[model samples]
Target: MIYLDANATTAASEEVRRAVLAAMQDGFGNPSSVHIRGTNARQTITNARDEVCLLIRGALPEGVTLTSGGTEANNIVLRGIPEAIIVTTSVEHPSVLRPAEAAAEHRVVPVLVDGRADPQAIAEALPASGDVIVSVQWANSETGVIQPVEDIVTTVRSRRPDVFVHIDAAQAIGRIPVHMDGIDALTFSGHKLHAPQGTGALVLGDPEETRLKAQILGGGQEGGRRSGTQNVPGAVGLGVAFRERAKAFDEATGALRAMRDAFEAAVLSAVPGMRVNGGSSPRVPNTSNILFPGIDAMALVALLDQRDIACSVGAACSSGRPEPSHVLLAMGLSEDDAYSSVRFSFSVMNTMDEALSAADIIAETVGKMR
Candidate 1:
C-alpha cells in the first residue's frame, strides 16, 4: 500500500521495532521500583527523555513529562491551565479544541484564505485583561500549513509577559526543526515520528516555573506532573526514532518536498477544478490537501483505498464525525468545499515513484467523478 496517511501515524522504523522488542523482553521492570532491573529500566526511561528532549531543542529535560499519547499530552496542558482566557484556532486538533471549550472564554483565531494561521489575528484575539493562554498547532496536521508559532508567541508574550504559549508540535517535531525557545510548552507524539504508539511528551519551560497542576495523580511519576508507571519499552523506541530522524531531517524533507511537488503538479494537470489547499502558505515538506469542489472526500478516500492508497479527509482522530472538517471551515471554505477536501500526508518512506503513481490514481478517480 502507498501509505500517505502519515499525519495520522507512521510505521515504526526497524531500529525502533527492535528497540521495543528488546525492551519488552528485558526491560519489563517498573521504573518506580528500586530493584536492579527496575533501576536499569528507570535509566532507560531517563535516556529516552534525553533523546526525546533533543527533538524540542533547548527544552529542559526535567520539564518533559511522558504520557500515553498526544491526546493525553494535550489534555495535560489544556486542562492544567485553569480559569484562563484560552486563545486558539478553530482549526486546531480536537484534543486541544475540545478542552479549550470548557475554559473561561475560548477565543478562536480564524485561519486566513490560504488556510494558514494568521499571527496577527491571533495577536488581536488576545484579551485586553486577565491571564491569557495561547495554544496553536506548530504545523497543521491536515493541510500541513505552518503556523507562525514564534510570531504568534511573540505577539502574545510582548502583549503580556504572563501569557502562556503552548504549541501542539505533533506534526512538526522530527520532520522540522523545533526550538523550545519562547514556547512555554510543546507536545509531540511518538507514532507520528516513526516510533511506537502509546508514547508522547509534553515539554514545558520549567516544572517549578509553570506551577503546573498534576492531571493524572497517583504514584507521583513524571516529577509528580503525571502519575503512572512509565512505558519503558515505548520510551526506548521513541528515543531511538528521534535520534534516527535527527541525523537527516533536512535532507529527508528536501526529498519529500520534491516528491510532493511532482505529485501535485501531475495531479493538478490531470484533473480540473482542483485547488491546492494551503498552497499559498509555508507548509511542511511532505503534505498536500487538494480540494475537489464537486467530489465527496470520504467517498474518494474509499475509492483510493480500494487501489491501495491510504489517505484521509481530515484528522484521523475525528474521522467518523458526520460534518465537514473544522480546519477547512475555519479557512472560510463552504461546507461543500470542506467536505470536498482530502488530506494526503507523506513521510520519508514514500518515494517519488509511489507519489507519482498515487497521483495518477487520484487524477483518474477524480476525473471519472468530474
Candidate 2:
C-alpha cells in the first residue's frame, strides 16, 4: 500500500518499537514506587522529557511533561490556565478550538485565505484588561501552513506581560524548526513523528512565571503538573523517536519537500482546476491539500483507496462526517470548494519514486472524474 497520510499517523520506527518493547518488559514498575524497577521507570520518563525539550530547542527539561497525546496536552493547558479570556484562531484543531469556545470569554480570530493566523488579528482580539491565554497552532494540521508563532507571542507580551501563550505544535515538531524561547507552553504528539500513538508531551517555558494547576488529579506524577501512572513504554518510544528524528533532520526535511513539491507540480500540470489550499503560505515540507474543483472529493478518495493509495479529506478525528472542512471555510472557501479538497501528507520513509508514481495514479484517477 502507498500510504500518503503521514499527517494522520506515522508508522513507528523499528528502533522505537524495540525501545517500547523493552520498556514494557523490564520497566513496568509504577514510577511512583520506591524500588529499583520504579526508579528505572522514572528515569526512562526523565530521559524522554529531556529528549522532547531538546527537540523544542531551549525548552527546559523541568517544564516538559508526558501526556496521552497532543489532545490531552492541549486540554491540560486550555483547561488548567487561570480563569481568563481565551483567544484562538478559527482554523485550529478542534482540541484547541472547542476548549476556547467553552471559555467564559473568548475570541476566534479569522485566518487569511492561506489558512495562516494573523498576528495582528490576535493582538486586536486581546482582552481590554485582564489575564488572558492566547492559543494558536504553531502550524495548521489540514493545510500544513505555518503560523506566525513568534510574532503572536511578541504581540501578546506587548499587550500584557502576564498574558500566557500556548502553541499546539502537533504537526510542526520533529518535522521543522520549533523554538520555545517566547512560547509559554507547547504541545506535540509522538505519532506525528515515528513513535507510537499513545505518547505525547507538553513543553513549558517557565512554570513559576506561568503557573498551571493540574486538572488531572491523581497520584502526583509529572512533577505534580500531570497526575497518573506514566506510560513508560510510550515514553521510551517517544524519546527514541525524537532522538532519532534530530539526526539528519535537515536532509530528511529537504527530501520530503522535494518529493511533495514534485507531486504537487505533477498534479497541477495533469489535472485541470487543481488549486492547492494554502498554496501561498509557508507550509511544512511534507503536506499538500489540493482542490479538485467540480469533482466530489469522497469519490476521488474512494478511487484512490481502491488502488491502495491512502490519503485523506481532512483531519483524522473529523473523518466520516460529510460536512465541509472548517479550516477551508475559515479561509473563505465556498462549501463546494471545501468539500472538493483532499490532503496528501508525506513522511521521511515515503520514497520519491513512489511519490511520482502516486502522482501519476492521482492524475489518471482524477482525470477520469473530470
Candidate 3:
C-alpha cells in the first residue's frame, strides 16, 4: 500500500528494528540495579539520552526523560504544572487540550484562519501576576501548519519571562530542525520518526528551574520525574532512528518536500474545487492537508484504501468520529468544508513516483465519485 498517513505513525526502519532486538537480547537488565548487566543497561540508556538530546540542539542530556510516547510526554508538562495558569491554543491535539483544560484555571487561545496561533493572542491570555504555562504544538498533525514557537516564546516572555513555554514537537522533531533555546519543555514521539512505537522523550530546558511535579510515582526512576523500569530496547531503537535521520537530514527533507509538492500540484490540477488547507503557511515538508469541497473526506479515504492507497480524514487518534475536525473548524471552515478535508502525510520511505501515482489515482477516484 502507498502509506501516506505518516503524521499518525511511521514504520520502523530495519536498522532501528535490529537495534531494538539487540538491546532486548543483551541489555535486558534493569537500569536501577547494580549488577554488571544492569550497569551495562544503565549505560545504554545514558547513551540514548545523549543521542536524543543532540537531536534537539542545545538540550541538556540530564533533562531528557524518556516516556511511553508523545501523549505521556505532553502530559508530564501540561498536568505536571498544576500551579500555573495553562494557556494553549484551540487547535492543539487532544493530548495537550484535554489536560490543559482539566486544570483549575486555563485559557484557550484562538488561532488565525491559517491554523496558526497568534503570539499576541497567547501573550494576552496570560495573567499579570501568577505563574503561567504556555503550551503549543510546533507543527499541527492535521494541517502541518507550523506555529511560530520562537516568536510565541519571545512575546510571552516579554510579558513574563518566567512564563513556562512547552512545545509538543511530535510532528516537528526529526522532520524539521528543533532547537531548545527559550523553550522550557519539548516533547517528541519515536513512532513519528521511523522508530518503534511506545518511545518518546520530554526534554526540560532547566529541570531544576521548572521543578515539575512527577506524574507517575514509584521506584524513583527517571531521576524521580517518571517512575518505572526503563524500556531499554525502545530507547536503543529511538536513539538509532534519530542518529540515522541526523546523518541524512538535508537529503531526506529535500526529497520529502519535492514529493509533497509534486503530489499536491498533480492532484490540484486534476481535481476541481481542491485547495491545500494550510498551503500559504510554513509547514513541515512531509504533510499535505487538502480541502475537497462537496466531497466527503471519509468516503475518499475509504475509496483510496480500496485502491491500495492510504490516507486519513484527520488525526488518527480522532478517526471514525462523526463530527468535523476541531483543527479545521478552528481555522474558520464550516462543518461541510471541514468534513470534506483530508490529510496526506509522507515519510522518507515514500518516493516521487508513488506520490504521483497516488495523485493520479486520487484524481480518477474523485472524478468517479463526482
Best by TM-score: 3
Instruction: Give the runs in model 3 whose Cα sits over 4 Å from its true position.
Output: 315-320
lDDT of 3 by residue, 242-289 (tens): 899888989989999999999999999999779999899999999999
What local lDDT score does residue 36 receive in model 1, on the 0 to 100 scale?
93
Which candidate would rank higher by TM-score, 1 or 3? 3
Which residue ranges in model 2 land beyond 4 Å of their true spot?
A: 315-320
lDDT agreement with native, every candidate: 0.87, 0.88, 0.92
* Candidate with better lDDT, 1 vs 3: 3
For every model shown, the clashing-pair count is 0, 0, 0
RMSD per candidate (Å) reads: 1.7, 1.5, 1.3
Clashing pairs in 3: none
Against the hidden reference, what TM-scores do the models get? 0.96, 0.97, 0.98
Model 3: lDDT of residue 4: 97
lDDT of 1 by residue, 295-331 (tens): 9998999999999999988644446565778888888
> What is the Cα root-mean-square deviation between model 1 and the actual structure?
1.7
Better of 1 and 2 by lDDT: 2
Residue pairs with colliding backbones in model 1 are none
